[model samples]
Target: MRYIAIDVGSTFLKAGQLDVQNLAITHMESIRMPEPLPNENPLRKEWNAIQLLELMKGLIDRQLASCPGCKGIWITTQMHGFIITDEYGVADTPYISWQDERGLEYADKLGTSYFSALMDRVGEKAWRRTGLWEKPGVAAVGLFHMLQQADLGLEIKRERQGKACAASMNDIQTLDSKRLCTLGGYLIQSLTGSHVCHITNAAPTGLVDVRAGKWDKDIVSAVGCQALQFPRIVVGIDSVGHYHSRWGGVPVYPDIGDHQASVLGSLADAKNEAIVNMGTAGWISRVSDAYRIGEWELRPYFEGRYLPTITKLPGGRNMAVLVRFIADVGQSIYGITLTEDTLWERLLAEADSFSQKFLAGERQAGKGQLHVHVGFYGGQTGTDSGAIDCINGDNLQVGGLFAAAMEEIAAIYERNLYVLATAGEAIRRITFSGGVMMKNAFLRDAIAKAVGIEAVMAPERDEVFLGLLRLALVSEGLYASVEETREVLLQKLHANNKGA
Candidate 1:
């Protein structure tokens, strides 16, 4: 059997064909996602919902054309972010991106931010029920901000009509018919005409009760959006509807979270293994049988499992800051131009060489080492910043700079891993995935050494596509469980390698 797999990623829209019998992915391709729509407020990031949907449809159509007799469609998407829709599932507002930060804007004369005011209104217990911290860009916070704006608009309208406007926070007629959904849920609704969300995709919105696997009524009421409709929550292996096209009607499964899918594709043992993924952003995640409230964020996983994750770690984007700096210096100071790829190649070579020597104690004590922090983009707390210190004439070279950055990232992972351990997650093995980890052996090795455990790479480079393939196998009843499916697939892959 064959299936079409798609990932609506933050950075790219990726698609491919998954051959179930052989467990291979073919015709894999990706296109950069459309840039966010221009905004007057620098912190507000958004996209044209209809335009993004059209682009996704075009990509899916292209893949469907290439793979004849495709049995079904499986999707995974970047978690969080939401779009407001009408009853017919048509977008009513721009897609608010997970990167949007309007919630961080000050909301009162005393200078409390929208996010802070939201937390105060919801209370700590209600917020903790969602298994998330008080942060901006979550769907719940966005919904609150929307309601406030509507109230303000309504008050102005009443004033213009020369009527007394009473505070009717719950009586906004404009929001009466509105619904909320993540980008993935919206895509499913657009394709299959069914308004449903998988638990994995919905859990990150800071609205769902992770332990109960449903929306928390208290949080909804606290946000003053009890009237707003949210998609019905679906669990494991359920089809939303069938997508009709020139080929035929294909079964479309509810979209899953990309983070969970990537970890699933890595084939890590949920009982004893943890995964570290580095893409545009980075996270370290480990699955738990029961939900636990702690420093880590808890997200829903397949089959009643939960993932305790440390997210927003420095990642590829942070490294690009340094690379772009070098590129700018070359162009501006020396009239030389270098592609990012070329610069990365040279930097990696230098960093790798220096790392080997440093690990072997070849450098004099503190002679060629620098302290580097690559948090150019903020961290989980949203206040962290990047820095490079201990810079001297001997350690200010490119090799030293990159080596320090890699070490610092590894150190950050190590610190987070300790936190996970303290919280009682016994992670015996580590599986590394994502573009940065897969391409950079130096970084992978640094992470392994820092964590004091040898790590292994994920079986496939495209973990998200591979994850969709695994989901198809289980959903089609080929395997009773994820563990069993992984075991069989790896066995076949090993046999194939032996024959080759």
Candidate 2:
């Protein structure tokens, strides 16, 4: 059997054909995500909902054309953003992305930010129920911002007028509805004609009672969003409906969160292993058999499992900051333009050389090294500032800078492991995935050495799609359980390697 796996990622929209019998991806394709729409408030990151839907459909059509015998479609997407839609799933507003920070803006006479006001009204219990950390970009925060604008009545009018003016030039819609869902849910509704989302995606919205496996009525009432329509929650294996395309009607599963999907795809042993994924952002997650709350964000995992995760750690995006800085200096001072790829090549080489020297006792740790904190973006503790300290004559260069940054990133992971430990998670090994870990061997080594554990790379390159494929298998009844499926697939992989 075959299934089509789609990942509506922040950076790219990816699709692949999963050959279930062989346990391998036969074909794959991707395109860059649509650029964010221009807004008067630069902090507001929005996308053309209809445009994104059309682009995703086009990508699926291309995939279906390549694999005509595909049995079903499974999707996973970037978490924590949403679009308002009507009963029929037609978008009423632009897609508010996770990068949107409108909630940070002051909202009232008391000068309380929208996020603060929402959290204040809802109280701390909402966070415990949702198993999510309070963030400005969460769907609840965005919805509260919209509700406040509508209640105040002036900003919504201005926004409506602006959208009306732009509607003639572009096909954008104005904000006019109360129903909201993630981009993945919107796609599933458009495809299968069902309005639903998986718990993995809904839990991040700060409205779901993750422990109860349903929407929290108290949170909905407290947020003053009782009029809003929320998607019905489903499990990973639940089929929403069928998508009737020209090729054929295929079973469409409910959309899941990309973070959960990537962890699932990592194929790490959930009992004693943890996963460290670094993409645009970074997170370290470990599976728990029961619901447990701690300093970390807890998310619903497949098979009634819960993942205690430390999210929003600096990763590839943070490294990009340093790369851009070096490139900017090169262009401005040396009158030469340097590409990011060239800069990364040089940086990785230098970092590797430094690691070799340190291991050989030629270079001493902390003697002349820079103390770099790569938290260019704020972390979970609300620490928005990052610093580089102990800078002296010996480590001010680009190579040493990147090396120090890598060390700091690794150290952050090491420090945060204690949070999981406090929550009673005993991690014996770490499975690493994401572009940063895949490309930078020195970073991987640094993290392994720091964590004092055996480290292994994720078996597959496209962990999101691989995860979706696993879900598809279970959903189709090919396997009795996720654990059984993993064991069988691992056995197949082992046998393939032995035969080779």
Candidate 3:
């Protein structure tokens, strides 16, 4: 079977068609976001779904024109999602950006503290033993909620067994009237008629119960979204649903977090491999079959819109801005613009030389001698347009390349790494993708050296789109399981790269 995958992102929507028989993407397309208002304030409504869908539809339609035989689809989006819907399944709101911390202010209203405390008791590791839910992010949110609710219900239920057990995690149900799913689920249902989700995307929202594979008790109480509203839960490899409507009802599967998708698409292999993808933002992730988490990870572990995980840290995109401050050392001398490909080639050459000197143990290390921003992203300036709003990635362009500001960014990135290593120690290897890395090969090499690991490039150019396409194909059940699919993929990639 052939499949079409739709990846609804913050500023863009991507779709790709894959030939399941060969397991390769045949066509790819993207739609850029419409510009925001003049005042930069969001309009009465951030976006209309119909318009967004039409945008998506147009992209998919164009691809379908080439691959008429496609029969399955997989859709995935940013981790925490929301879209308003009408009686006819039309959405009122476009899916919000996974990067949108607009919900950050609602943290208190959502009872985030309770979950924060709960992590202290439980953990962020994936206990993937059968019958025990072990998803990491948003999926953990829902599962944890179910366990909490079950505990609460068990407390409320006066059964002898229940009384003997003291409310534990095992007595949860999927029948909750007030189950809530991220806005993405609603969008999936509207498009395909199946309310389904996957572990990766679901885990990021603090919504899934990692151990129980259900909603966290506190989440439903706080978010008040009905479980019935949830799309059916499917393994990342299961058939999501048929595309059905205009694009043809191809079966669809959901993907996990966008970063997770990027991780998988990067071809990051087991326990030690990881990567730092610098694009609109940067993310460093390593893969593990078993989850590693601790009290330290627990305390600072943020209960994001999804389930709790240990590797949680400050922002990434903001960190890139910090690099830019110091980047001008070579860039300015060469008259290179951040976005210019040719300019970057020259800048990278100089950065490589500068980085080598620093790496060769020639630079003195005194806290006061040189300082940069790595732990948090602010007081920095970079060329990225959204860098400022995302304080974690924003910078003020304090000094030219090699300037104090630039030094600060390197310092900050290093500091951030220390903090992350302290929490997500399980990351084994680092991989990288995205335009930023492409622009600054020196930075990529520098980051790899800092982590003491080799950074693997993504198999294809856009891991984001590949992940979505992978999800679409997986959800279609074109293959029996993700593991199997992965095996096939590995074989094919090996065959192709044999000479390399």
| Cα lDDT, all candidates | 0.81, 0.80, 0.48
What tens digits encode model 3's per-residue C-alpha lDDT throughout 301-358?
Answer: 1112111122332233544454555467557787655664554455455545544554
Better of 1 and 2 by lDDT: 1
lDDT of 1 by residue, 1-500 (tens): 78998899888899999998888898988999988876678888878788888888888899999888888889888888898777777776677878888788776642687788888888988787787767787888877776776655532111112222343434444666867888888898989988888888887888888788889988888787787888999887768899999999988999899998998898887777889999988888888887688898887788777888888888888899999898898999999997777889999999887766663563556364687877797544322778899877666778878988998888888888878765455778899999889988888988898888859999888898888888888888888877777887778778877999
In model 1, pairs of residues that clash are none
> What C-alpha root-mean-square deviation, in Å, does candidate 3 show against the real structure?
11.2
In terms of lDDT, model 2 sits at 0.80
Q: Write the per-residue lDDT of candidate 2 for residues 1-500, one digit (tens) a residue.
A: 88888888889998888887778886799899988877788779988888888888988888889877778888889988988777678777788888888899897753799888888888887668889888888888887787676556544321231252222211222333446787889999899878788888888888889988898998877766676677888865777899999998978888889998898889899788889998888899988998888889889998888999988887898889888888889899999986777788888998777656653453444365676777687543323567888877666767778888898888888888767766555888999998788888888998899999999999888888778778777877888877777887778778877999
Error of 2 at 27 (Å): 1.3
Model 2 spans with C-alpha error above 4 angstroms:
156-178, 358-368, 379-384, 495-500
Ranking by lDDT: 1, 2, 3
Per-residue error at 284 for model 3, in Å?
3.1
- Which regions of candidate 1 are displaced past 4 Å? 109-111, 154-173, 357-368, 381-383, 423-425
| lDDT winner, 1 or 3 | 1
